[model samples]
Target chain A: METIKNLLMGFSVLLTPENMLYSFGGVLIGQIVGILPGLGSVIAIAVLLPFTYSLDPIPALVAFCGIYYGSQFGGAISSILINAPGTESAVMTTVDGYPMAKKGQAGRALGTAAISSFTGGMAGSILVVLLAGPLVQMIISFAAPEYLALMIFAMACITGMAEKSSQAKSIVAICTGLALGTIGLDVSFGAPRMTFGSLALYEGISFIILAIGVFAMAEVMRNVSNAKHNGLQRIHAMEVVGRVGISLKDWKLIIPTHIRCTLVGFFIGVLPGVGAATATPLCYSLEKKIIGEDNAEWGKGEIRGVAAPESANNSCAMGALMPLLTLGVPGSSSAAIMLTAFMILGIQPGPLLFQNHPDILWALLASFFIGNVMLLVINLPLVRYCVKLVQVPTELLFMSVWILAIVGSYAVGLRVFDVGMICILSVLGVVYGICKIPLAPMLVAILLGDMIEYYLAATIVLCRRSFVNFMSRPIVLLFLVLAVLVIVLPMLRDRFKKNKVQSAVDIIDAPE
Target chain B: MKSRQDLLFEIKVSVFLLVFALVYVILTLVGIDTSGRFLQGNAGLDPTTFPYFIGIVFTGTAFYLLVKSIYQYRLNTEKENTDAAKGIGIPVVEKKPFPFPVKASLVPYIAFIVYIATLRLFGFILDSVLLSIVILFYLNQKNRMRNIIFAIVFPVFVFLLFNKVLDVRLPIGYIFGAKY
Candidate 1:
């Protein structure tokens, strides 16, 4: 009853004309950003962070939430029409989505994707409301030791689970972030650590600057280079013929896939380090495995294939927010930027956020529900127009991105130094990309570094510097054990896989 | 071996990381002040403690990476030799080089630095517009008119949206002597 009342209050807060307009604007921009290849919600949000400084928390947050899931809706459009995913999370959508487009079922593919995304978002929002309260309640009593352990666990998971990067590189990235995080005046000592006498370094590198540099500017650099080499591939979007609405029969086929994927995606999203990119592929594979290759086309315009990933992607995005809102731990890169937004808005998200700022929490949740509906309304009727976003020239698009990144970074503190830092970090980002080093762990570490240090400091004070006393706390010990397991298990699994491959190769050589 | 270039890249990255970690540790030790003590006195952790810990761990991990990469490179070399001696055919995969050479990639960075340095003199709108045009032209030299138009219009739009509407004060050019 209280939850329902709170949700109503949230809806009331969000229903204002101004808030609604901001939400609409955010969604619209997100849709455009999504349609443009090489742009994602992370860059959009990071670039927009400086602008949000002037607005009230609620309107700013509402706009951000709209952009968050709005991109998911936009991503599927490109995936279906141009066979290019607007975001990494939308990659799986191209497999069946493009095939459907090729078969002149582009409308059907897009329709399924939009509806599934809406359903998944709505379902995920409901789950967030239900799950957030319980999760907060459980973690509200945690002390410094447990919080420290939890952060370690999160970092460990990110380092362990990062795709296509070696663990050593991930560790280096995380440490670099931690090192960067320590540049400012210490929270405890009030002494500057590594400012090197620059006042600009006193507050440390702004998260907004780092985010734009790494995510947006670095990406623009890569895209520009690629365009220079290969030239921008002119988009030939498939025609969206016929009605864009999914039929009742199509709905019947999609409903089950939606339910299963939402659940799968939500759970995966709740886990730190795993995100929609992981969830979408998993859901796609799960759908393929369940439907079986013989029964379904799998890759060739299967509606379930379209449904599974789209459903999972949006739900996973919502699921990533669960930890952010409840535990103050970001579950993904997008969530990390949102966490930064919350801080910029002077709102701290965590267990006490419900007690202290229930209005903000519930209103944000309500916006998700509202945003999903708005996305569906905008997506269904305007998809044909939206597909034209693919026709945007890559050179022009990237140039605008570079301008936005520069202006946004400069706007953060009105400092040319910040703008210069963007270039430096962008160069580093390019290096990291070239080396195949995962950036997520570094980002997460940077965001969490201060908090991790605070908790560690508090823990030291609480335990009187006794390691045994620190380990005596059951929750802390459990988290530490889990962290170790998270790190070790992946290593063991990789070793096993390598050994198995080597043995197979040996057998092949012996027989030959 | 096809992976020789990749191994060399990894080795270089590992060595860079190793040097970075060492420098990080040295900086933390020299730069951070630990004279002020907490409630626990000398036993209490200081601002440098976390950074030191991170630096040491980073150094260890980077060292591990360096050793691992060197071993992998040696193994790859041995495999290549074995394959060659056995007259075995190896598939040569064509790897796409990064479109921009090091020097070429540095051009955008240099342009950005110049843009920032000139922002105060030229102002946000003018500098941004000029930067946009240059970048758009660099990206594609053919679409002169379209690029020029877009370069002007978009920055003005962003300027109005940010400076006028959002109420964030963007710099006006000192050359024009325009006051907000």
Candidate 2:
């Protein structure tokens, strides 16, 4: 009932014309950012951050939320239409999405992605209302130990998995972040470490500067350096296989896929380290298994495959947002940037964000609910019209990316140094990408580095850093065990799969 | 044996990174005095530790990468005769070169650096417009005049939104900030 009442208040807040315009502005920019390769939510958010300095916090937040969510929605368009994944989360969607688009069900494929995104988005918003406030409360009472444990859990999921076959790259990426996090003044110990007398090092590398630079700017570098271009092949191979109209036949098929994908997306989302990027692939594979290979088109333009990943990714994107809003433990790269945003606002996220700023929280949550509905209505009939967006002339599109990057960095502090800093990090991002290093771990390491050390220091004080006391604490012990399991269990599972494959191959090769 | 170049490069980068990490860890331990003025927010638990911790992790991960990449390279040589060597992922195998937008990406990449660097000199409004025009110019975009026009106009629009409307001050770069 309280949730209902708050949402009503939230609707009233979001319904105001100014806020609605903010939401519209966010979605509009988000779509463009999402579609463009080499740019991500952080860049867009950072770019937009400066613009929001004068607005009410809620409206500013609403706009930021729009950029993040809008980017996810827009990411699908490029991933499906082109083979390139616009957002890291959209990578999996490209696997099956592009294939379906290539098979001539482009419109249907796009429609399913848009509609499924709306469904999962709505479901995530509902979950946020029920779960966020309570979760925030639970978090507020948490001692340093609990926060440390949660950070450890988040680190485990990110560093331990990252889904890539190469564990080496993932580890390297994580270590890179850990190293960077340690730079700057060691305020706890009252020392400047690693600055080497350079004043820049004392301030420490800004996460957004690094994120935008490494992820967006570096990407620009790499893309430009690469002399080859894969022109959009689907346009030439155009074939609309799925029924043109989302007829009753189409609705019957997609609705079930939509619901299933939403459940899968949300469940995956609520967990640490797993998000839409993971959920999209998981949903796609699951949908294939459920539908059976013969009837289902798995890849090759199957509507279900397209819808499942799209819906799951969108759902997962929202699902990812929930934990960050309530608990402050960001679950994805974009969420990590959002954490940076909250810090800028001087608002410590976690459970207190809900209590201290219920109006803001409620307004932001309700905006998503309405924004998502707007997405559905806008996407179904209106997205076809949004094709005009693609026609906005490439110059404007890319120029806006640069503009936003400047706007966001400057907005954070009218500091000229950060703009310089963003470029340096972008170069590093390109290097990390080249090495096949998993970025998830790096972001996690950066986010958790402070948390881990803080908790460790506190524990040392509480238990006198005594070995026995430290080892004896139940939560600490549990975290230790969980941490070991996180690393070891995944290795064992992977090794088991490898061994099984080898044995099967040997058996097949043996003379009978 | 693992090929010399890959193993050597891996070891070299790892050692450089490790040394860097050690220096950081040592400095954090030394605790240079910051006097009371610098601290603002979460500095008590040690702002240095998290990122230094990041450095340590980087060093550790680099060591891991160096060792594993070397080990895999050796294994790949022995398995070279097998079909799995070329199939799917046979770690250490080189990927086919990226085939698209080969030259076009450089346009944006260089423009980014130029735009960022010139933020103060060109002023946010002028540099933004100039950088946008230069980047689009590289893309072989046919509409140069329009592109230049938008680049100049767009930042003015951004200036209006951020500075005038939102009341957030931006670096007028050198142009607007200088005493004329």
Candidate 3:
């Protein structure tokens, strides 16, 4: 009854004209930004962070939420039309989405993606409403030790579960982030640790500057070198996108997959550090397994392939946002930026947030529900128009991106130093990309670093200067054990697989 | 054997990380004030403690990367030699050379640095407009009219959107004394 009342109150706050307009604007910008190659929710939110500085907290939250959800919708457009994913999460979609487009069922493929995304998003929001309150209540008992252990577990999970990168590279990336995080004023003692006498380094590096440099600028450098002069030709291929509505038969087919993907994605999302990048591929592979690898339709424009991932991606977004709202810990890169925005707005998200800022929390949740609906209504009809976004010339697109990145960096502090820093990071980002190092873990580490340090400091004080006392807490021990398992289990599995392969090869050689 | 590009990239990154870690360690040691270090009975209360821990971890990781990359090069070489001895036919994959831009890829980055460096003297609009045109020309974008329009419009659009509507401040030109 209280939940229903709270939801009703939330809807009342959300339906106000001003909040509604902000939500609409956020998703609108998100969709457009998502359709653009090389721009994702992270860049969108980061670039828009400075602009949100002056707005009311509710509207700011609404706009950011819109961008977050809207980008997921936009990412699928290019993946289907041009075989290029607009967001990293959309990478899985392109595998079967583009193939479906090639088969001239582009409309059906896009329709399935959009509808499944809506279903998944709704499931995620509903789960947040149902589960977050209870979860927060449970976690409220946690002390600094448990929280510190949780952060370590999250980092370990990220390093261990990163699908494509080597564990060594992931570890290096995380360590690099931790190192960068230690820059500027030490929170505990208020002493500068590594500022090197520069005032700009006093506040440490801005997350927006790092994001713009690594994602936007690094992407421009890569595209400028690898892209064809006539890369815009892919936009003409947009004509095949027929009509954007799923068939009744196809809807029936995806019903089970949608339910499974949403549950998996939402649960993974609730877990800190694991994100849509993990969820989507897991959903894809699970679907392939269910369909059986022998099935010819699995990868060759199978509607389920598009449906499963798109659903999981959006559901994951919802799941990721829950921790950021209910707890202060962010579950994904986008949520990390959102948490930064929350800090900028002078609002701390946690259990007390429900009591102290119930208005903001409820209204933000309400807007999320509305924003998903808005995205669906806005995206389906505009699929044809959104597809034309790919038609923008590379030169024009790159120039616009560069301008946005420069202007956005300047807008942050209105300082030239930020621009200089962004330029340097961009170069480093290019190098990291060339070396096959993952950038996300590093970004995650940087964002979570201060919290980790803060918790560690608090734990030390609480334990009376003995780190061993942390093990006395059951929850803390559990988190530490989980972290160890996360790091070790993958290596064990890999070694097992290697041994099995070697035995099979040996047997073949001996018999021959 | 490992590709030259792969080896060069790995070595460059390893060296860069090593240097970065080294600088971090040196700066933390020098810049941090240890006057209050012993005052806090809990070592975690000392600000330098976390930074030192991160620094050591960073240094260790960089060293591991350096050693592992070099080892991988030796292992690849041995594998190549073994394959050659067995007369195994190795597939020669065609390597795509890095597309060396006409003005070089460094041009845009350099242009951006110059723009920011000149922000106070030239202002955001003037510097941005000039940079856009220069970058487009450098990229060999052929549409002169579109380039001119975009060059003028994008900066003005960003300036107006941010400065006027968003109420964000921007740097004005010292040369023309334009206030923004």
Candidate 4:
């Protein structure tokens, strides 16, 4: 009843002519950003940030939220066609989606991705509108000690998601981030801890600089050392493609995977510090479980493979915003950036968001539903045509990306320093490509590292450094228990799997 | 054999960082004067306390890493007695590292860095022109005329977009500075 009334109120706010147009425009631009590789929502959002300063807070916020998710829908297009993930979350989508494209089922893969993304986005929005209230209350109930337990869950999730052989490397990268976070000045004590007496280092590193460097630039550099996947030319992407509807059998196979992935993505997205970059891989792995060993078409354009990852990640990506909208604690990296945007407008996002600012919140929540519907309506028909956008040649492609990055960063502060940083980071990104290390962990780490550490130190301060609060709390204990189970359960399952197979074979032999 | 090289490189970097952290710890312990004016916090509890605590943890982790890397190196070297990389089971395809369409990508990375460094000298317009041309060259197509067209058009477009419309100043280099 509460959700229904609120959603209805939200719909009323969205129906306004100006707000409706902005949402449509936001997603329309978002698709182009998605269709283009190396330029994702981060850069697109970064670019779009300055223009919205003139608008009222609600319309601006709604437009941005639309762009954020719309870009996600767009990312699936690139991955499905060229195997190039438009968004980090869409990276996993490419693993299966591109193969489908190669198989000339480009239409089917595109349709499936678009449909599943729409459903997943709806599911995630519903979670935001309804479930977020209770979730925040639950998250806030944990005392400092319990927070320590939760932070441990966050860390384990990171480790669980890390590429093996580089597991230690990921932790090292995180530790480095935690260290970098302390450089400007200690928050508690104003004394500069790591500034080394540099004038520029006093404020420490700018989040914009870090975001541009780690996410945008580093990724660019990493891409350079590799082979130019001329795979784009190979996928002719005829207009006739994307028309093949989902095969009935494929639908049956994928429906379960979609639900599972959406759940996985939504829940993971809801976790602070866990991001689409992490959630997509987790969903892909989860999809492997439902697949039959012999009949499963994994790694070769399986519908389940495409559906499970995209649906889950897109859902999860939206899930990251709930905490931001509800509690003011950012649920994801992008949400943190958006939170800053809200703060700049002097409209802090917190528990107060629901009650005091009903108009804005209503429009925002409505935009989620309306925007998602808009995205489906906007993206589906365009899927057939948008595939041709990638045919834009390489030199033109990268030049446009450079031009856009510069334009976006400069718009943020109009500071030449920002453009300078953008160019520097873009170059650095290419070099990082030469190194085998993935950039996602570094970007996510940079975003969450300081916040996690700040909260951690504050928790220690508040708890009198006591261990009892963590042990006493229900959620904290539950998280700890789950953390333990995740690490232990896999080994146990492997053992059980081996033993059961052995027994089944032995029984058959005995009858023989 | 190539995998052996990769393992060695990782081992080397890990060892180097571990050593760096250990040295930092030893120096800090022996009165390295880390408690500078900046580290001093009023009301007894200082910022130095956090730095020292984190430094100690970092030192310990680095030492543990050093030990782990050494152990891994020795174990891998012995187990691979005949020199096969511990195949994380990724079947290494015999494909050469850049088969034609691949090698062209490497140039842009260098050009990207070069453009950044030369930004002030060349101005945003000229630097962009150079960068786009370099990229076109990297793609290695016939028709210098097309490259010239892109080389000219790309920079002008970006200039009009960012500098003119957005009012974000792009460096015009020394030549434009004198003229203006």
Best by lDDT: 1
DockQ of each: 0.62, 0.39, 0.55, 0.26
Once fitted onto the true fold, the runs of candidate 1 whose alpha carbons sit more than 4 angstroms away are A495-512, B34-43, B90-100, B178-180
- Model 4 global lDDT (CA atoms, 0 to 1): 0.67
lDDT of 4 at B57: 61
- lDDT tens readout by residue for model 4, A151-190: 5665566555555455555565555445545666666555
- Best-matching candidate per DockQ: 1
For each candidate, the alpha-carbon lDDT, in order, equals 0.86, 0.70, 0.82, 0.67
All predictions: root-mean-square deviation over Cα? 2.2, 4.7, 2.5, 5.5
Error of 4 at A384 (Å): 1.8
Number of the predicted model whose TM-score against the real structure is largest = 1
Give candidate 1's error at residue A346 in angstroms: 1.2
DockQ of candidate 3 relative to the true structure: 0.55
Which CAPRI quality tier does the interface of model 1 achieve? medium
Ranking by TM-score: 1, 3, 2, 4
lDDT of 3: 0.82
TM-score of candidate 3 chain B vs. the reference: 0.79
**Model 2: what is its DockQ?**
0.39
Name model 3 segments beyond 4 Å from true.
A163-165, A225-235, A294-296, B1-12, B35-39, B89-103, B178-180
Off by over 4 Å in 4: A37-39, A46-56, A83-104, A139-149, A223-239, A242-257, A273-305, A327-352, A355-358, A407-435, A468-512, B1-3, B16-45, B49-66, B82-123, B138-180
